[model samples]
Each structure stands twice: as C-alpha cells, then as structure tokens.
Target chain A: MESNTVISIQNLVKRFPVGGDFFTALKNVDLKLHKGEFTGLIGPSGSGKTTLLNIIGGLDSASEGTVRVLDQSLDNTTHNERAKLRRKYMGFIFQSYNLLPVYTVFENIELPLILNKIDQANRIKRVNQAIEWVGLTNKRNSKPNMLSGGECQRTAIARALVHEPVLVMADEPTANLDAENSHNIMRILTKLNNELDTSFVFATHDEKIMGYLKRIIRLEDGNIINDKKIKKEDV
Target chain B: MLFKIALKNLLGAKLRTFLNVFVTAISFFMIIFMTGLYDGMRQHAKQVTIDTEIAGGAYWHPLYDPMEPILFEDSHSTLPQDIRSLVEKNKAVPILVSQAAIYPNGRIMPVIMKGIDPGQNIVNMPTNTLNNNKDINIPVLIGKGMANNAKLNVGDSFTIRWLDSDGTYDADEGTVVHIMDTENFKLDIGHIWIPIKKAQEMLAMKDEVTYVSYAIGEKKVKKSDGWIHRDVNYLIQDIEAAIEADKPSIQIMFTILLSLAAMGIFNAQVLSIFRRGKEIGTLMALGMTRAKVVGLFTLEGGINAILASALTVFPFGIILWWTAKHGVPMPMDYTEMGFMIAKRLMPIYSFGLIITTTILVFSIVIIVSYLPSRRIAKMKPTDALRGKTGI
Candidate 1:
C-alpha cells in the first residue's frame, strides 16, 4: 500500500447466501483508490458496484481477499474496530439523503463530529462551516422533512464532509434528484472534495454523476470491464 | 451525550412516550400507596391493641392460649407476689377470663367473661362502669359488639351462665351498666366484663386471675415462678400474622401493575427498533457501536421511569400527600372485622418504602428496554439500512 492510497483491494470476493447456495456479488476484484481522487464505480443495478464500495468503506467484509482502508485492513478488524475506522476517517452518503429525519440540518451535519467526541465549541464551529460550504446556512435549523430534496442531499453532503475525513463513500447520491438538483449537489461535492483534499468513491450508473468523476471504473456482471481516467475537458 | 440522544428520541416520539410514562407513573403511585396503606393498617392495629388490650406487656399463666377458649378454664392461677405487688402499686392490672354464655331475647349466645378491677386505669376499657348499679345482681360492662349481638342496652338484664372452678354451672341475672366502643375487637366482640371482686365471688375462683397486664411503657419483668412474661411484639403476633397472611394478594396486584408498565415500555421499544431500523443503521454507519445503540434505546426506556417519577409529582404525588396528611376514609365500617382499623386510615410512607419502590420500578424499565434493544447486536448494518426486520 502506498502512503497516498486511501483504499487498497486485492482479489476481493463477497458472497451472499441463497437457498442452499451462494450468490456472489463481487468476484475476484482488484482496485486501489488514492487520496484527493474523485472516482466512481459505474454500473447498473446488481453489477456489484455497491458491494465493492461497502467493502472498501468497512461496512461489509470480503470473503476471500484483503481490503485495507487508510492503513487498516478490514479483514482482521472487529465490528467495533470497523465502526471506529468509519468514525475517525470515513464518511458516508446515501442516495435517499439518509439524514436523520428528526434532526435539524445543523444537527445532522454535526453527528460525525459528535461521534468523534469533539468539543462542543469545535463541533458547532465545524458544523456551521460545513453548512455554509453546502450553501444551507439558512436551513441549518430546519429538519430534513422541511427541506427540499436538493436541500436534504446538501445536508447529507455537509455531514459527509463536516469531519474532514480522509475518505467519503457515496452510493447513488443523486438518484432521487432532478437534473438541476443533481448538478447542484455534484458541484457542491466537487467543491468540497477539492477544498478538503478528501478521497471520494461513488457507486452510481447515472450519466450526470459520471460526468463529474475524474476516474470511472465500469463493472458488468460482478466483474470490472473497464477502468479509465479522464480529464474534465473530455466530458 | 447518550442521555441527550435518548431524551431527544423519547421527546420526538410525543404521544407514545407520554403513554408509556403515564402507565409507569400510575404503577409507581399504586405500589407506594398500597404498601403505605398496609403499613398504616399494621401500625394502627398494633398501637390500638397496645393501648386497649395488651398495654406495655403482660405476665401470662403457663397454660394460657388466647386462641383456645376451652383452655380458659385451666389457664388461671393466683398471682405471684411480685405481680401482685405491681397490681397493688397501681402499675399493673389483673384480668381473669372464663368461657360463658348469655341468654338474651330468647337466644342462647356463647361468650367469654373477663374480670377486671373496676378502679384500675391501666387499660382503656371502661371497667369503672361496673362500679355503678350496686343494687343489681351483676353490673357488667359489655362492649358495643356484645351489646349489639345480645340486643341488650344499658340497664338491660340477661342471664349469664358459666362453669365454676369446681366444674359446676351457675347462672345469674347480669345488667349491662355500659356499652363501651373500642377498636380492639379482642376486648369487644362477644365478651363481658365484670368487677374482679364480684366475678371472684360468683365464680368461686377467689384471688385467682388469668393474666396481669402492666401499664403502658412499664418495665417488663423476668419470668416469675411458672408465669411467662410476653413482650409487646410477642403479644401482637396475632395481628401481625393476620396481616402477613393477606400479603400475597397484594403482591399479586403489584406484579400485575408492574408487568403492565413493563409491557408498555417493552412494546414501545420493540416498535421503535422495528420502525427506525434505517436510523439505527445510519447511527452505526456514523460510528456508533451496537452496544451504544442498545444503551441508547435502554436509556430511552429507563427515562420513562425518570419521567414517570416526575409525572407522579402531579395528581398522584398530591393525592398521596393529601391522604398521608388527612387519612383515607374507608368505604365501610371495619369494626366488626376484628382488625382494629381506624375509620380514616392514615397511610405511612416510610423512607425505605419510597427508595425501594423507585429502584424497583427503574430497574424494571431498564430491563424491558434492554431486552428488545438486544436485537440491534445481531443486526447486519446493510440489512438494517435496507429496512429489513431483524425480529
């Protein structure tokens, strides 16, 4: 593993149990993600893109190969250790904008910092800054139910960036948004990615999302078919 | 931090939280109130029995057993010099008990005849009433219960029959001089009281008595000759035993109330976990360990007890406080039940009772809360995020 590598996966295999048999999700996959890189696992549903992303995020385990994120191997770690890894160095965003519905935007953004046991003054300051970065300062005190889809997705992005984690894994982040909201969210995420120098891995098949990725790994039938790097001008 | 999250979740639940807390508060109040009432009954019964019948303590004849009325004939003995000295000094009162019957209104009713010194003021019984009606064949002091049963009022005459020490039956016309009302049913129901001298002359049991009762707070003496000195606690065993026998029903009630409250909390926790699987998964995703998640839910449940305790301060607490201050009026007369219960029973809420009740209810809430929350430990974060039910 290089010092710049945020995630290193070697021949990773993940399986789920079917009736008296096993259904493989990711098959003998090899991948490496570096710091400050904007990458996406581009695939349709059931192409194992989400499975690979979950393995790298330490939310799920590999059955056969080693997955190391930020110098820690996921295979040997306990559930509590995995939680600590996510708590200290990783953030997550879901397509559904999984911000806790009962919490206000500021509270949702402050959750990671709270889990990190940051002091109250620091938490408030960082949460306010993240809210500003997402252009949601006016809606910071509004709960998710009160926010538009775009605003809710912005809050999720703010939460994923509030702790300045080394890695952020987003799955179908813009699946539920319109083209305008999708672009707006991608723009905010791209700005935060550059500003924070955070590594980002997105699993999505959306063309709008693909345009924003500097590197794209395409998967088909649980296997990677192409891995390519592109410049912003090429899109 | 955990407390803050738990409280937020509970408050966010709104009506569900209120309903659980209300049930818990009701259980808490009912337990304390019922226990306090029982305590009041015990204390009142003990105190009144001591004041009216047992006094401070007594010296009982070796053969005396209050439950065995057949032994009353053989349970009498001439007082020892030491006890006689106490009676002479007005520090004690001697009583002779015998099994007898009364004929009133053409009814043959059995009874117990007690002989006490008319001038003795050691006990609260109105024995001085026997001193009146010197011209009557026998001026007897009957309690309200005996008088009511015999249909004999003051100055009414009835035929009393009893066996003498020689085993010969004798009869006399007894006039009721007074009907005294007392809480101690042992000294009231189906009992007749006559002056010791007249009773001794009539029964041919000269200078012999059953037991001697010392004045209230009198120093207890060691056993003299064949006599047994019974302490106040020993003498009050019947009342205590009666109360102890009735405790199981109260215990069953407590179990039901506590179960209802616990069940409410348990159901709420189950529903919270089931409905908020995504939220739980999200929390785990953000780095909360499953144990912490369980603690969070358990704390939510435990907070019901805290909130219930706070809720108890309104209505429940006020009602308890008012009842403590000015006794609860019993629905019916309990004098005939022979239990020395006051008309308005005062509740005694001891410090120990309150502390024990709080800890008990709090622990139950925590346990029920934790029982359902344990499912979080077995849940796969991915499955939870997909809104899959673990239980």
Candidate 2:
C-alpha cells in the first residue's frame, strides 16, 4: 500500500453468471488513484468502465481480485461495513441526475449530511453552503421537476459534495444534459476538486467529460489498454 | 429527515394518498361507531327492563315459569301479611297472571293477562287507565303493539275467556280503556293489563297472586315456601347474556373494515416501491442502508394512518357527538321486533373502544407497509440505480 494512494486495484476480475455460464466484465485490471487527482475511466459502452467504478465505489463486490478504498479492503469488508465506508468516505453521482423528485433542491443536497446524523443547525449551514457551491441558491426550494437540466445537474453535484467526502465517483453525470449544461457541470466539479483537494473518479464515454480529466485510463472490452496523464498547459 | 421525506412524498401524490387515508379513516370511525351503537342498545335495553318488568327485584312463585303458560294456573299463592303491608304502602304490586283467549273481530288471539293495581307506582305501565268508571264492563288496558295486531281500539269491547282456579271455563266482556305505547316490547306483546281485584274476581282466585313486584325502594321480601327472591341483576341476566353473545360478530365486522383499510395502504406501498425504484437506489448510493430505505417507506405508510386519524376525528366525531346528544332514530320500531332496542338510540363511545380501534388500525398499516418494502432489501443497488424492477 502506497502512503498517498486512496484507491488501489490489482489483478481485479468480475464475472457474472449468464445462462449457467460466466461473462467476465473486468479482467486482470490494475489501477491506482493518488490523493487529489481528477481521473476518468474512459471507454465505450461495453468497455466495463461503470463495472469498475461500481466495484471501486463499494456498490458491488469484487469476485477474484484485491481492491482497497480509503485504506479499507473491499474483498474482506461485510456488506454493512461497505455501506458505512461509502457513507463516511465516498459519494456518488449518476447519469440522469437522480435527485429525489419529491424533495426540494436544498433537501436533496441535505440528504447525505442527514444520513451522517449531523446536528440540525450545522446541517442547515452546510446545506446552504453546498447550495451556493453549485450555484443553485436561487433555485434551492425548487423540486427536480421545476429545475432545468443544468440546474438539476448542479443539484446532483451539490448533493454529492455536501458531505465533503474524500472520493467522489460519478457514472456519466452529464449524460442527460445538453453541451452547455454539461460544460457548466464539469467546470463546477473541477473547481470543487481543485479547491477542496479531493479525489474525483468518473466513468464516462463523452469527449467533453474527457477534456477535464488530468489522468485518463482507456478501457477496451474488459482490459485497460492505455493510461496517460495530461498536463494543465496541454489543453 | 426520513419522516419529512415520507410526508412530502405523500403530499406530492395527493389523490393516491387521500384515497387510502379516507378509506382507513372511515374504517376507524365506523368500527368505533358501530360497537358504541350496539353497546348503547344493550344499555337502553337493561334500563328499560329495570323500569318496567324488574323494579329492583321481585318475589316469584317457585313453580312459575313465565315460558310455560300451562303452569300459570297453579303458580299462585294467597298474599301474606308482609306483602299486604307493602301493597298498602304502594311499594308492591301483586300481579295475577293468566293465559286467556280474546275474541277480537271474530278472530281468537291468545294473550297473557296481568292484573296490576291502579294506584301502585311499583312499575312503569299505563295501568292508571284501569280507573275508567265503566261499571257494566271490566275495564282493561292494552299496549299499542297488541292493539295494532288485534285491530282493537280504545272504547272497544271484546270477550275474554279464561279457566278459573277450580278448572272451570269462565267468559266475560271487557272494555279497552287505554292504548299505551312503551319501550319494552315484553310488556306489550300479546299482553293485557287490568286491576288485580277485578282479575281475582274474574278468575275466582281471591287474594291470590302470581308474583309480588317490589317498587324502586322496596327490599327484604320475606321468603315463603312457594316464592323465590330474584335480585335485579338476576332478573335481567338473560338480556345481558344475549347482548354479550353478539360481540364476536361485531368484532368480525370491524375486522373486515380494517382489512379493507389495510389493503388500501398495502397497495399504495407496493406501487411506491415499483414506481420509486430510482429514488430508492439513489438513497442507497447516497449511503443509506437498505434497512433505512425500508424504514423510510414504512414510515410513509404509517404517516397515512396518522393523517387519517387527523382527517377523520373531527367529521366522524361530529357525527358521533350529534348522535349522542340527540339520539339517532331507527327507521322501524326496534322494540316491536323483540330486539330490546329503543326507537331512538344514543351510542355510547367507551374509552376502551376508541383506544383499541386506533391501535388495531395503526398496527395494520405499519405491518402492511413493511411487507411491501421488504423487497428493497433484496434489491441490488446497481439494478435499482438503473431504475430496474427485478427484471
């Protein structure tokens, strides 16, 4: 284990049973994420990027490999321990900006903090701050149905970051948004990652999302074919 | 936070939430209302009997079985000195009961004849009508139920035939001096009332009575060899037992209404799981345990019960209050059907009834809500995140 490594994966393999046979989703995948890095698992639809993201996020168990997240081994942790790990150290964003439709934007952002059992006065203060961070202050009381695509995506970002998790995993977070909303979301996400010194990992196929990544791991089918770092001045 | 979210969800789907809560509220209201109404009827029946047939207590001839009219011919004794003293004080009424056939409109109708004193206030009856000064004809009082059945009216004349103590058949014509209405059908159905002395002369059994009915304040009826002391509670025991026997059926009816309410809540819970799959998965991904998700859904369902209680208390309470204050009228004469019910009933809502109903309904809502939410524990977060429903 490296001192600064927050996520380390080695010889990882995930197999699913289909029609009494096995379909491998990831094979001998090796990856490492250091602190404060903005990274993307870049791949096409069948490239197993989301599968690896799900595994690293503790949403799925690894079948035949070692994976460690935030210094906790994914292979040995119990289901509840994995849940606690996610609650304390990880946050997730999804493709469709899955904000609870019945909840207001402020409430959606407050959910993670509430799950952590933060006190009411501080919870309200943090929620308002997160609302400002996502630039949805004017739309704080609006529900998901009342918000535009960019606003909804901003609310999802606010929800994911409200608890100040060490690692944020987003699976195609801007898939449903137009190009303008997509760029706006990436700018806020990048600014948060740089300013807070938090690690970010995204699973995406979009060229636009790839533009913001400092490190890109390219996946072909079930294998990682290329890993590269982009300098800030290169863009 | 979970409760707030649950409440917001319920408020969001306004119509679905309302239908479930309305059905449950109605069940809650009706369950308490029906039981209270039935209890009220029982109470009314006991009170009316206390006022009419059993005034505190009575002394009955040991051989007298009110059911067996054949034994009434021998179920009598000469009045004792203590009983005579009570009669003098107007605290006891000696009734000589005999079975007779009346010729009314040329149709023979068998009836029970009770002779009560005109001046005695031991029981509530229209026996005062026996004071009519019609010397040529024996004046008798009849209830409206009997009058309706026999087509007899006040001032009408009829022939009554009875067998005297010597086993001789005697016949005479009597005039109907009053037609009274009462709450106790046992006092009215197939019965007629006349003066005790006139009954003694008519039956040729002087100074003999079937039973000595003590007034409201009378006690210490001396036990004779042929009479038994029956307490007031013992006199009304049959009615109390009959009312007790009807309770299980009433519970079953309320259980059914509660089931309807439970089913409504259960259906809503199931639909919520199916419809809100994405929301559930999002919560799971946001670090909520599956149990907490289940708790959130169950809490939502429980909120329905609380809301239903809030929604129903005032309106149903108003109806119950109005019914209690001003008795609710029955479409038909209840006492006439021999049900021991009054024409108007004031429902008695006991504290026990309301508490039990609330507990039963709230418990069912919680259980049914949790039943459907259990599927969340079995749901794979990845699939749920994709908005899939097990398929």
Candidate 3:
C-alpha cells in the first residue's frame, strides 16, 4: 500500500473455457508493482505468467479478483475505458514484436500516440525522441522486416515509450531473439527505466533475464511460488 | 495509415490478390455484358418507335385499339370521296394514305405494299423516306434482308405474288426503285415500301386501302379527337406490343438470368471477406475500429467496381453502336410485320441500372466485411495476437 505503488492485485484468478470446460490459468495470484520498478514474472510453460501479465495490462480480464492500476479498477472498467487507460498509462511489447510491417520504424513508434489522438506534430517530436533514446534514430524510416532483431526490439521499445506511459508490460519479449539481441533489448529497457522512471513488468522464463531484474516473482502451476526483491547492492 | 497497411497486405500476397481481383473482374464483366445485352435490346426496340416521326392517323391492332385496322379486299375500304373532303376541311389533318401486307412467295416473305398517292405519300412516310434518285419515282423500297434474300437490288425487277379474295394467285413485276436502309418498326429483317398506286395494281385491288393515315400539323396532339397522331412512336409501340405478345416467355427468362447474375456478385463479395479473415484480425489488433475497417474494405470494393465498369464500357459501347448502324436481318417470315432487326445489339446506357449495380456490389462488399470486422473488433487483444481463428 505504498504511495509509489502503480499496480495492485488481490487474489486474481483467470479461467479460460477449453473444449466446453473451464481451465484455470491463474489461481489466486497476488502481486504489487511500484513506480520505476523493474520486475520480472518468471515461470515455466502453463504456469500462468502470461495470464497474470495480460490481466495487469488490461489486455485480458481476470475471472475473479480486485485488479487496480493507476487507481483505476479493472473489474468495473468498460472496454473503451480499459483501452483509454492502457493508451494513457500502459504500453505492451509482445513476443512477436508486432511492429506493423507496412509502416516505417517512425510510424510504428508513433502508433500508440496516434491511437491516443495526439497531434501529428507532437507525435513526431515524441516519436523522434523515443527513437533517439532507444539509439535507433538512424533507422527511423526502415520497415520492421528490413531491420535486425535487436533493431526491431528497439523500435518496439520506442513505440512503448513514445506515449510517455507509466508502465510497460512485455510478455516474453525476448523469446524470439538471440542471446546478443536479448541482452541488447534488456539493456535498452533498463536504460529507459532508469532515465524515464517508467516501470516494466516482464513475463519471461529466461534465467538471464531474471538475473538482471530488480525483483523476480516465480510461478508454479498458476500460483506464485516465490516473490523475491533484489537490492541495488546485491547486483 | 491503416489503408496503407491494408494495401501493403493486399500487395504482399501478389498471387492471392491477383486471383481475387481476377475473379471479381470476370464476374463483373459477365454481369455488365449480360445487362448490356438487355439494355441494347430495350434501346433497339425504342429507337424505331421513339426516334421516327410518322405522319399518319395512327393504326392500332384490334386488341390495343389505338387505331382501327381496315382490311383491303378490293377498293371497298378506300376512303369515300367525302372522307377526303372531311379530312381536308379539318386544318388539323394533312394527307391521308392506306397500307396493307401482301403475302408474296407464299406466307414466308410477305411484302408490305401501301396504297399511297404520290403527293400524299410525302406526308404519310417518315421524314427520311427512300425515293428513286433518278426521277423521284414512287417505287417499292425493299429492306436489306429482303434485298439480300431475294437477290434484288434497287434497279432489279421482282414480281409481287398474292392470293386474291377469290383464292387465285395474282402476280405483277415492278422495278425495285429504292431499298430502305433504315430499320423498320418491328425490328424484323425484311421491309418493302411501294407507291400506293403500284401496290394497288400489283395486288389486283381497285380502289381499296387497308388503313388510312393522315399527318397532323403539330408534333404534339391530343388523342381526344378519335385519331392518334401517326408518329414513329406509335409504330414502335405497335411493333413492341406485337413482339412482346408473341414472346412473353422470353422476357421472363431474361429477368431470371439477370437476377441470378446479381446474386453471383453478392456471393463473390461475401467469399472475399471470408478469405481475408487473418488480415482482418491483424488490422483489428492494430486498434483500428470496426467502422474504419469497414470503410477501408468498402473503398476497395468501390475501386474494383469502378475499374470493372470502365473495363466493360468500351467493348459494350462499340458493339452497341455497330448493331445500331448495321441491323441484323431476320428470316423472311418475320418481315410481314415490318420488322428490321439490327445485326448488332446496342445497349441502352441507363444510369439507374449502373448505379443500382454499383450499389449492390458495394453493399455486398460491406455486408461481407461487416461480420468479420465486428468479430475482429470484439476479439481480445491476446487472442488476436495468438492468431485464433474467428468462426
């Protein structure tokens, strides 16, 4: 219940209907994320890491829980409201990068701003700044297909930050990249976190990713097995 | 931006996109072609009747009763001497003439021979009546088909063979002074025009006439005077009514065919939407609203319709013009009705038909786009990203 807490979840449960039967994806998950915190949710396959991340990001609804982000209750928000909230306060980076292949890097970065109805001139300025921050200004006009994996991920990060959101939810963002590209993306995310004071919540199973995060929450069979915080001194 | 993305996606799958456009274009082409034929037939039917201004007291078949049909036996049906005075007294009436069909060479090739005074013939015939170039002689004008079938030219001599009321064959040979280049009222291939005196002589009739025709001063006249203005329109209506009555079943068959073509267009659009399911899902996941997506597809459909329409116009226009100029010749049997069928069919360009077809095409595209776009819009972002198929 700290004043800096950006997301708070209580007994969150998500069940998806499969073959006409309900399958539990998340079981009574509880978590708290503070502003500017670099958190990782690490779990094996079918361990509810993605379901938990989706619920927090407003991309999916929890079957039962009290989910609050930026003082807004997800349980009662309309689809539009959730969309607007996500646009204003949250950004998402998917495992596939999801950069609109038809758009240039700059346009892809400017997408979230455009969705939020930001003026074109201001969007251009913010997008350029975000590109520069991610060290991808040189490739601003390149399409996602033309860029390398690390560059694509950098564009994704630029898109995530262009709207100046408070939090970024990345679901297995590094799952499709090589080790070197993964390291580069993590470095970019860490740098953005430090410079902009933006919080990041990652759902990942990579041990290398867990070692770099300020906190790690491990899940097993849809339940959190351990929630550990690492101090700056430990790293 | 969304349009750019959609276009890029469309272009990315070059083969698939080409196939879609090809199928759509073919369907549209066939639809336009079939509809054009119908339009051409309608125009051909209208032109003969609507374009010509015939100056005569109109004659109607018995059923329509637009005019009285006077059967010419000998000279009995001829106007009484006082009838000419009566026609002349009325300033509204002009020259009066009579006409009838004579079965020549049996019933297959009936020759239309009218009993017209040379001076009165000028008023009874259409403005562009065929005349002997040499001496302005009132000779029989044969249609192209009749001329071709009988191997008779403008100067050739042919005999008119008809059975008198006494059931005897009467024959007379006259020079083919003029051949009508124009299509007749019925759009039949064969037509024969002759001077009233010569026609009476050939048919062995004395002072008989089939029906009386007189010109009115003005183009517009009230039908209340018991005499219908003898104009090209009446001729056309007479022919059309006759043909329509003759082939009532054909019109119904064409209507059904047209309706089926329309349904084919609708089905094509629906199949196109179903085929692009993944692409629609991707677009929705990109935060495009259902309305915007629908607009995009509708625009695409409009583009296709316009392109297809343009593609169809040129060939159709040329074909129609050709048919209008060089009419088709029907068999000699149909000539008895004064039918001059065009060799080529000319389509009537109707804005209503084009607009209706365009709207139908667009609506089908929209209807097809609707369910998919709505389903995509309602999809969960995570589910869309996972590439879940929309049922």
Interface RMSD for all numbered candidates = 1.1, 1.6, 3.9
* Window of ten residues with lowest summed lDDT in model 1 chain B: B260-269
lDDT of 2 by residue, B217-294 (tens): 677766455577778888988888877897797778777867776676667657766778888888888888878788
Give lDDT tens digits, candidate 3, residues B234-270.
5556657756774555446545644564455556555
| Docking class of predicted structure 1 | medium
Q: Candidate order by TM-score, highest to lowest?
A: 2, 1, 3
RMSD of each: 3.7, 2.8, 6.2
User: At residue B225, what lDDT does model 2 achieve?
Assistant: 57
| Cα deviation of B358, candidate 1, in Å | 3.5
Residue B154 C-alpha lDDT in model 1? 90
Every candidate's DockQ is 0.59, 0.58, 0.28
Candidate 3 per-residue lDDT over residues A1-235, each given as its tens digit? 5779999999999999999899999999888999999999999999999988888877789999899998888999876677667768888887877776657898778777776778878988999899988899789888888998888888888888888789898988899899988888898899889988999999999876776799999999899999999998887
Best by lDDT: 1
> For residues A1-235, could you state the per-residue lDDT of candidate 1 as single tens digits?
7999998889988899999999999888998889999999999899999989888877788889988899998999999999999989999999898888778898889888988999999999999999999999999889888999999999999998899999999999999999999999899888888989999999998998888898999998889999999887888
Cα lDDT for residue B307, model 2? 90
